[model samples]
Every structure is written in C-alpha cells, then in structure tokens.
Target chain A: MTITVDRKIYSDKCISNAIYWLSEKYIIERKLDGDIETISVNDDNGENFRTEFLRRLNDFKLREIIETETKDIKTILYAKAFGDFEE
Target chain B: MKKYALLPFNFTQIDGKDVLINELGDMIIAEEGTAQKIVNRTLNDEELYKTLVAKFFISEQLLPPLIDIYAARLRMKKGFMDDKTALHIFVLTLRCNQNCTYCQATSREENAAKCSMSIDDMVNAVKLMFKSPSKHLTMEFQGGEPSLEYELIKTGITKAEEINVAEKRKITYVLCTNCRNLSDELLQLCLKYNVQISTSLDGPDFIHNQNRGKADSYQKTIAGIAKARKILGNDAVAALMTTSELSLNYPKEIVDEYIKQGFNGMFLRALNPYGLASENENWQKYNDRFIAFYKTALDYIIELNKHGTFFREEYATIILRKILTPYTTGFVDLQSPAGIVNSVLIYNYDGYVYASDESRMLAEKGNFTFRLGKISDKYEDIVSGKKVRKISEIWSNEVLAGCSNCVVRVYCGADPVRNHSTQGDMYGFRPTSFFCKKIRQ
Candidate 1:
C-alpha cells in the first residue's frame, strides 16, 4: 500500500505521527521526493488500510493546527500552575 | 465566540459530537463544528459561549478575570505530586499456596527459600517508608501470598507503628492476600492493628477454581473472607478481579458473583505484560475482548445501581469522578504525572526498593529497569537518583507525544513501566498502545 501525502497540506510531524501508529502492524517505508512524501506499507486487502490511515492523518492534521495555535497559551497555563512567577 | 481568545484545550469526537476538555478536566459536549468555530472565532451559541467561558475553555479577554482560579484548579488537579509517595508496598515473600494460571507475582512453592525479606531488611524498609513527606502513608503488604509469611507482615507493621509514634504521620496498613489460608493468628493481628484486607476472587466456583489452579481454592477463599469479615469489619475487606481470557466470556456472571459475595463493587482490572501473564498468545485480541467485557459488566452494574442495588464499577467511578467532580482521584493509574514515584513505591523482599509493584515482577525476570536502590540507601539518593530523573522526563502524559494533545489528557496518565515492558521503550508508540485503547474506551 502506497500513500502519497503533499507536504503543503500536512506537516512532517503530522504525517510521521500518523505513520508511527501503523508501523507496528506494517512494514512501512517512507521516502521524500521534493514536496511530496510517499509512504509504503505491507498491503492489507482493500480500502481498510487507506481509510484508517487517512482518518488518523486527518486527526493529526487537526491536532497540529491546534498545537500551533495554542502552544503559547499552554505554556502560560502550565507555568501559571507550576512556576513561581509573579502574578 | 465574540472577540474571545482560546485557552489551552483539546477535543475528541465522542458519539459523533465534539467533546472538548479543558486543562483542568472540565468538559463541554457541543456540536461537531464547535472546535473549528472556536479556533476561527465564529461560535454563535450563547449558552455554549457562557459554558466555554465558565469552564475555562475560552477567555473573553487576553487573560480571563478568573485566571488565578483557573491556575489554582490546575494546581489542585496535580496535588498528588505535593503528597510525594503515599502508598508504600512491602513485598513480604514470593511463596504461595495456590497456583494461579495468570499469576503476575511470579509466586514460588510455599517452601521457597531465600525469597523472603529478612527481619533486618523489613525494619530498614519500614524506616525508609517514613522518609517520604506524604502526610498520610499506607503500608501495603503483598506477595505470592503475604499471609504465608505472617512474621514479616507483623514485623513490618509493628516497625512502621513504632516509627509513626515519633514521626506523627497518619498511617494505613493493607494486607494483599489470597485468603486461601488466612490463619486465626493473622486475623487476630489484623483485628489488633486495623489492617484492611485486599483479596482476589475471579468469579463463581468453576471460574475461580479454574483460574486459581486448585479445586478447593474457592471454598477456602470464601471461608477465609467470612472469617475476616467476622473479625475485621465488612468494609475492611475488599476483592479485586482480573479479566482473564476465560473470565471475558462471563462478564455478568462475574458481577453477579461479586454481588452474591456481598461485595459492593469490583475492580475490573486487565492483565499486564509481566510474569506468567505475559505468555498471553494474543494481546490485541485479548485487549479488545477485555474492553467489551468491561463495558458489559459496567452496563450491568449501572443497571443494578438504577434498580436500587448499591453496586458500582470501581474503574468507571474513578474515570467519572475525574470528569464530573472538581477533585482528583487517589487511583495511581489515572494520574497525569504518572503514579510511579509520586504516588506509590515498592519495598521488595530482595532488600531493594522498586518504582512500583510491577517493577519488582519485572525484576523477577532479571529486568531491573525500575529498581530504585537498596533498602539501606538514603531516601534522597533513591528517589533523586539519575535513573528516577530519567523516568521523570517522560512520566507525565501532558508531555508525551500522542498524549499531549489528547482530549482525555486531563483524565489520563502515562505509564512508562507499561511502555517499557510492552513496547521496549519508555516513550511508547501510542496509536497501537493497548493502554491507550483500553483507557480511551
């Protein structure tokens, strides 16, 4: 099974994390060619593997967006809770 | 949302609805597009808007007026860290009377020599337990069968009591025994010291005997429980069950057995990858089956609750308490910073200290990854050693890759021991993590 994901649509972190989950069951090989990243895994029968991988990919993409937007607030929140900072 | 800023939060799709959880574990179930709308600042629901603000999910200003309160709640949630290590387990010995098919304790024959903690080691371990700054301390005794080594259990508690007189710390004593042969002398000691008894009972006679590897094991255990209840109060004795491959087939039967035995609830614990239990042929299939078994039992327990039976599923209660209440659960497995050194420590019979009970089981197989130090070592050195520091780096779920942005991160915890045992690494791959799959469900 081959999956080609455009670098413009998803970050490396998202794609890698999505693949990390599937690496346990499949022999996944990842290669980079310019802006396109191709991932190959041991073939499953049909649409199940692609569907599951795409679902996880989409979830990670959403998570990357959330992390990018709220990284600063999260730091501030944790610091406020644990750090000895002046109010 | 009208001119609002997002507070750090995460969401997951549950039952086709976006369930958003804030940093402090406060949750809001809203429409599917709620997360994108919140990020885009296009939320229009007034009720949800008020809820989001009230729950610390969103801020009307750069910093909410109640930011201090929010910070306080966050601090309170991680309050277990302030308590240091509260539950100290003492492994009395590895000797056992009954042979369990899926024994995690790595039990040996009753005559197994050089496996029991020495009297001097017991004294040293008790002394070491008092070093923790936790105000309330629980000294839990476990083994292949702790009751088999009556003298060690007596010495450990007596030593702890002797120290507590001057130390002035609140203390609790627990005996993790099989109840197969809880002798009269042991019951007398338990009665004298107010020791709480924790035992394991798989299910009805057939199931219990099959798992226990003894035909009369169930009878002896039931009789022992009756004697213990007669001596110690009913509330002082509790039973826990592990979902074995055979046990999964009869979830309702298991619950029914617990209720019949007069137990108010049961902990539907899963078998971990340690000791004899690690020989499981297929873990993923077993995990999937266990989850289904857990849900069936939980639903039956809930139905019983609705019908005036005061029974509860202990695991569900812990998870629900995190979601519905404003307090933290004392359960070690569900804590965010991970409960290893922060919540529980094990004093093994080998005169060594371990991070947790499972750590010692791993040691039985020559894996010393979690062995902290010797019983004679200074408390500071044992807890603050380089090994502990390395574990602390990845202890919190808030920092783990897959867990950091998880919707249930506030309620879930990290288990580096499980990670190391199952996945051969402390930084576990989360997507295929059995722990993740089980807890998330």
Candidate 2:
C-alpha cells in the first residue's frame, strides 16, 4: 500500500518517526517528491496498513506540536533540577 | 475560565476517572472531560483549576512561583543517578543442577566445564565496582545457581571485604540462586558476610516441580529456604516467582502458596524475551493473559491485606511507591534512563561487562550488542563507549515519542534491552509493545 501524505501538514521528522515505528511490522519505503511524501508499506500482518499508518502519522504530528510547545519549559524545568547555578 | 499555558502533562482514563500526571509525577484524579476542558482552555471549575496550578500541571503565570522547588523535587526523584552504578551483578557461573523449562539465563549442565568466572576476573570486576562512586554498593551474585560455586562467592566477598577496609563503602551482598544446592559451606559464608538469599518458588508442588523440571524440586527448594532462613535469619531470605503459561492459570493459588509458605510478600514476575523463554512463540497471548493473571493475584493479595494478613504484591508496591510517594524506587527495570549502565552493571562469567542481566542473556544467544566491554577495559571507556552513547539516545521516556504523551510514563520506565530484543530497535514502538501495554494497564 502506497499512501501520499502532504509534507506541509506532516513534517519530515513526523513522517520519519512514524515510519521508524512501523518499520518493525512493515517493510516501509519512503520518498519525498515536492510537497507530497509517498510511503510504500509491505505489511506482514496482512491487515489494512494504510489507516493505521495514517493514524500513527497524525499522532506523531500532534506529538511534534506538543514537543515544540513544551520544549522550552521542559528545558527550564530540567535545568533548574539538575543544573548547578550560583544564585 | 481563563487562558492558561500547559506545563507538560499527560492524561488517561483509569477507573472511570481522568487521571492527570504532571512532569514531576504528581497526579490528580478529576472528573471525566477534565482533560478535554484543560486542553481546550475551558476548565471553569475554580477549585480544580487552583489545584492543577498548585500542582504545577498548568501555569497561570509564566514560570510558577515555586518552579525552583518543583525542579528540586524532580531532581530528588532521580537521586538514584546522583551516585554512579550501585547494583553490580556478578554472573558467578552458568552451571546448574536442575533443568528448568522457562530458564531465561540459559544455564548449562551441573558440570559444564570452564563456564565459571575466574578469580582474576572477579578481582578486576570488584576493582571496577569500587570505581563507581556509589556510597552504598550491592554485589549481587547471579548464576545457574551461584551456590554451586561457593568458593568463588567466598573469594569475591573476601576480596571486597579486604578492599572495603579502606574504601569503607557500605557494601551489601545478594545471592540469586535456585536454592536446590544451599550447602552448609554456602550458608556459613552467607552468615559470615550477611549475604541475602534471593531464590525462586513458582508456586505449590505441582507448579514449582513442573516449572523446575524436577518432581521433588519443590521439596528441595522448601527445605533449602528453611535451612537458609534458620541460619541467615528470616528477614535475610527473599523469594521471587516467575509466572509462566501454566503459572498464569493459578494466580490465586500461587498467592495462597506464597502465604502458605510463610512469605510476607512475593514478586509476580513475568517472563522476559530472553534465551529459552523467548522461544515461546506466543508472546502477545502470554502478555495479555499475564496482565489478567497479575491483576487477579494482586486483588487476592489486597483482600488478604484487608483481612488482616500482611501479604503484599511487590511489583504493585513498586508502582504504588512511584504513584503515591514523593520518592523514587530503586527498582532498575522501572526507571527512566533505562537503568542499564546508569544504575546497574553486569560482570558476566565470560569476563565481559554487559549493561544488565538481560543484556548478558542476549549474549547467550550470540547478540553482544549491549556488552559494554571486557572486564579489563577502562571503566570510563566501558561506561561511555559508542554503544552506551547510542543507548542513551532512547533511554529516557520523557523524550521518547509514545512515552512522552503517556500519563503513566511518569510512573513507568524505559527499557532499551527489552525494546531491542522484542522490537529490533532500541527506541521501541510503544503502540506495538507488550511492555508498554502491560505497564500502562
């Protein structure tokens, strides 16, 4: 199954992460052409891989958003916790 | 309702309540739709809002007033890593007397020649252990049966005792054995050095005997436990159970068996994907059933506690300690940074240093991916080598993809060895991981 996702909607990192996870169960081959990223999956489970792939892709996209929004705060929290500062 | 910024939290539905866990692992059980309201900026309940803010789940003001204090608490939660590795596992030998069906360690026959650790390697491993700056050190002797090599055990401890006269670190010794061969000499050595015995007892006679592949295995083990307890004192002997497919069907019976044996608590350990145990091709099914078995056993134990019996499930206690207490547990499996080389290091019988017990088990099957280095290698090089660097990338649940968004991840752990063995990747796919599923449940 080959699915084309809009690269604008899902960044390369999100797509790659989704592919990395799915690669365990599916032989995934990914290619980027302009704004569209085509993912070809050879699933061993013989199930509908497209829906699950898209769902995981969207999940990674949401995760990317959350990570971006919380990155600075997380850094501040961890630094305050583990870093040595002379205040 | 006021607009408030989120402060790195995750939510999950547990027992019909929305459980929100913050970055520092503080949890709040709120009504259903609470998570949706918080995400959509529509949380109007003034009291709940104030509680969330106070708990550092949401920040009404940029940087909560007690941000430093919150950070300090988080730091304290990870205080296990403050000292270097504390739990040092010495794989004494791979020789065993009994043939167990689900033996994960891949033990050899009783007289398997040249599979034991040499005195030279033991000395070097002890030296490597002292290099770790942990104020308290645990020298855990693991084997097909460490009691089989009583001389090696005595030599290793005697060396540690001699070295500690000046080193003065609080060193604790633990022997992980099958207890079928707890000889008089072994007990005397344990009594001399105060070595704690951790043995296996799957269930009653039928289950234990079948799992051990010896009909009188249960009797021998029971007798061994009694002898060890009599010599080392009752508190010094601890027993753990491995829940195989057969053991799963008898959860209540197993709990009852432990209570019958006069044990106050027991760890309902699931089978790890390693060695002969990994050959069981029905991991998914086993995992599902194991969860059910665990819950049933835990409920029964809780009932016993309610009925004035002091029996507790050790695994649930570890999770509860993380959920209910402000302090972190010393359980290596359930820690962020994966606990591999961070909290424990394995000195295998083959004169190599591996990441953990499972890492060495992987070596038994010809996978040396987690083998840090030889015992003779520099401590700095072994701990900070290329492989360790690669493992570090995915050892933290806070940064992992699926784990970052999990409400239970704060209470759970990151397992790279299990991930690598089961998923073929150090950074495991939690959506497809049985470990993630079981822990989340």
Candidate 3:
C-alpha cells in the first residue's frame, strides 16, 4: 500500500516518526518527490497498514503543531523552574 | 471571550470528552472539541474560561500574574532531583537457599564463593552514600537472600550509624529478604536499628511454593514471617508479591492471601524482564494479561474498601497520589529524569556501583552497560561522568517525542535502564514500548 502525504500538511519529521512506529510490523519505504512525500508499506500479509499509518501520521502532525507553538513557552517555564532567571 | 494567552498544556480525548492537562498535571474534563475551541480562541463558556485561567492552562495576561507560583509547583513536581539519590541499595550477597522460578537476581548457590560483598568495599559504599546531599537517606539491603549474610548486613548498618553521629541525616534501613531464615539475632538487629523487613510472599501455599521452587518453602516463609512479626511487630514488616504466569490466573486469590497474612496493602509487581525470568518467550501477551490481572485485583481491592474493609493497592495509590496531589512520591520508578542517579543508586556486591537495582540484575547476565564506577572511585566522577551525561539526554519524558505530547506525561516517567535493557537504546521508541503500553493503560 502506498500513501502520498503532503509535506505542507505534515513535515518529514512527523512522517518519519510515524514510519518508525509502523516499521516494526511492516517493511516501509519512502520517497520524496518535491512537496509530496510518497510512503509505501510492503505488507503482503493483507493487514490494513494504511489506517494505522494515517492515524499515527495525523497524531504526529497534531503533536508537531503543539510543540512548535509551545516550544518557547515551555523553555521559559523550564528556565523559570530550574535555570537562573533574571527577573 | 476576552483575549487570552496560552500557557503550555496538552490534551487528549477520553470517554468522548476532551481531557486537558496542564504543565503541572492539573486536569479539566470538558465536552468534545473543547481543545480546538481553546486553541482557536472560540471558547464561549465563561466558567470554563475562568477555570482554565485558574488552572494555569491559559493566561488572562501575557504572563500569568501567578507565574512564580506555577513555576514553584512545577519545581515541587520534580523535587526528587533536588533530594539527590536518597535511596542507596546495598547488594549484600548473591547466595540463595531456595531457587525462585522467576529469579531475576540470578542467585548463586548457598556455598558460592566470592559472591558476597567484602567489608572494605561495603564501608566505602556506606561512606559514598553519606556523601549524597539528601537530608533523608534510605539504606536498603537486597540480595538473593540478604539475611543469609547477617554479618555483612550488620557491618553495613553499623558503619552508617557510626558516620551519622556528625552527619545527623535521617537514615532509614530496609532489609529486603526472603523470610525463610529470619533468625533471632537478625530480628534483634532489626529491632535495635529500627530496620523494616520487606519480604516476598508470591501467594497462597500452592502458588508461593510453586514460584519459590520448593515444596516446604511456603511453610518456612510463613513461620519466618510469624517470627519476624512477633519480634519486630506487625507494622514493621511488609510483604510484596510478584505476578508470575500462574499467579495471573489467581488475582483475587492473591489479594485474599495478602489479607489472610494481615497485610493492609499489597504491591502487585509484575515479573521484570531480567535474569532467569527473561526466559519467558511472549512478553506482549504476558503484559496484556498482567494489565487485566492488575485491574481485576484493583477492582476487588476497591470493592473491599467500599465494604467497610480498608485495603490498598500500592501501585494505584502511587498513581492516585500523582494525580490527586501536588507532592512527589519516593517511588524511583515513577520519577522524571529517569530515577537512575537522581533518586536511587546501587552499591553491588561485585565492588561496583550501578544505576539502579535492575542495572545490577543486567550485570548478573554479563551486561555492564549501567556499571557507573568502582566503589573506590570518587562520587563526582561516577555520577557526573560521560555515561551519565548521555543518559541525561532521554531521562525525562517531557522532551521525548511520543511522551511530550501525551496526556498522561505528567503522571508518568522516563526509564533509561528499561529502555536500554529492552529496546537496545536509552531513548526508547514509545509507539510499541511495553512500559508505555502498561502505564498508559
């Protein structure tokens, strides 16, 4: 099964993390053709890897959004908690 | 809604509700799409808006007026790191009498030579333990059978006592032993130093004997427990049980066994993947069964609690404490920064220091991946060395890929030893991690 994930929607890191998870069960292959990233799962066992892959892809994308938005705030919070802060 | 700034928080869907958890583990359960509403600034509920602001999920000002209080609470959550290696486990000896079916310690026979800790090395380990800056210190003795080496245990305690005259640290002594031979002298030493007895009792006679690999093992252990209780008082002794393959089928029976033995609580510890126990072929199936077994046992315990009987499940209590309170637990397994050198260290019989108890078990299998340094080495070099620097990278789940965004990250921890032992790396892959699966479930 082959799925094309748009790089604009999901970054390469998100796709790679999703693949790292599913790679345990399936022989996954990936190719980058410009903005569209094509992912192929060599699952001859008839298992529906696409659903699991898409679920993880969406979850990672959500996580990526959260991390990108909150990275600076988290840094400030941690710094205030542990690091020497100039008030 | 008024314009508001977001404080760092994460959300996940559970029971058709959006459960939002803040940086300090404070949670709010709301209707579906609540997280999207909050993120999109479309939330219209005035009460929820107020609640979110009060819980540090959102800031009415660009910087929350109480940001210092929020940082203090966050600091308290990770305060175990500041305590700095409070629990020092001394592996007295590896000699054993009964062979456990799932012996993770890799115990040697009773007559095995060179398996016990030497006095010189033990004294050095005790001195090293005193060097820790923690005000409260726990010196726990563990072994194939710690009671078997009575003199070594005595020496270790006496050395600590002697040093504490000036150090004046509050020290706790725990003897982790199989109660097969809690002799009168040993019980006397325990009573003198106020040492707590922590012994193993797998279950009822049939289950315990089977796991202990002896026909008369249960009888000896029960008698020993009675003797220890008679000498040391009931409250001073605590028993723990490990869930073996056979033990999983009898969760209720196990709980009943603890009640029958007059224990107020039971710790339902699963068999770890180390030593002889690692020989089990199917950990995935075993982990699933263990989870079901834990739930069944926990439900039974809760039912007992509701029926005018007070019983506690220790593991659940730890989780509940994390969820319900702002304080940190002494449980090393459930600490951020991975508990290795932060909260506990192992002084092994092999004259080497290790990261944790499980690290010493890995050593029994000829894997010294966690061997920090020799007992004779300086404490600073051992704890702050290059290996520890590498481990520090992935010790906290807050920075890990899967766990950072997890709803339960606040209630969970990172375990580098478990990762290295099971996943071949210190930074574990959480998607299929058994630890992640069990804890998240």
Question: Per-residue lDDT of B267-306 in model 3, one digit per residue for the tens?
Answer: 9999998989888999989999999999999999999999
For model 3, name the residue pairs that clash: none
- Chain A TM-score, each candidate: 0.89, 0.85, 0.89
lDDT of each residue in B186-246, candidate 1, tens digit only: 9999999999999999999889999999999999999989999999989999999987899
Name the lDDT value of residue B217 in candidate 2: 97
In model 2, what are the clashing residue pairs, if there are any?
Answer: none
**Residue range with the least summed lDDT across 10 consecutive positions in model 1 chain B:** B1-10
lDDT of 2 by residue, B1-441 (tens): 566777877666668887888777888999976876776678889999999888888887767778888898898788777756999999999999899999999999999999999989999999999988799999999998888998889889999999999999999999998888988988999999999999999999999999999999999999999999999999999999999899999999999999898899999999999989999989999999999999999999999999999998998998888888889898999899779999999999999999999999999999999999999999999999998998999899978987766668888889999999999988888878999888878
Each candidate's interface RMSD:
1.9, 2.9, 2.1
Off by over 4 Å in 1: A1-9, A24-55, A85-87
How many clashing residue pairs, candidate 3?
0
Model 1's CAPRI class? medium
Those runs of model 3 whose alpha carbons end farther than 4 Å from true positions after fitting are A44-48, A85-87
TM-score of each: 0.95, 0.90, 0.95
> Best-fitting candidate, measured by DockQ?
1
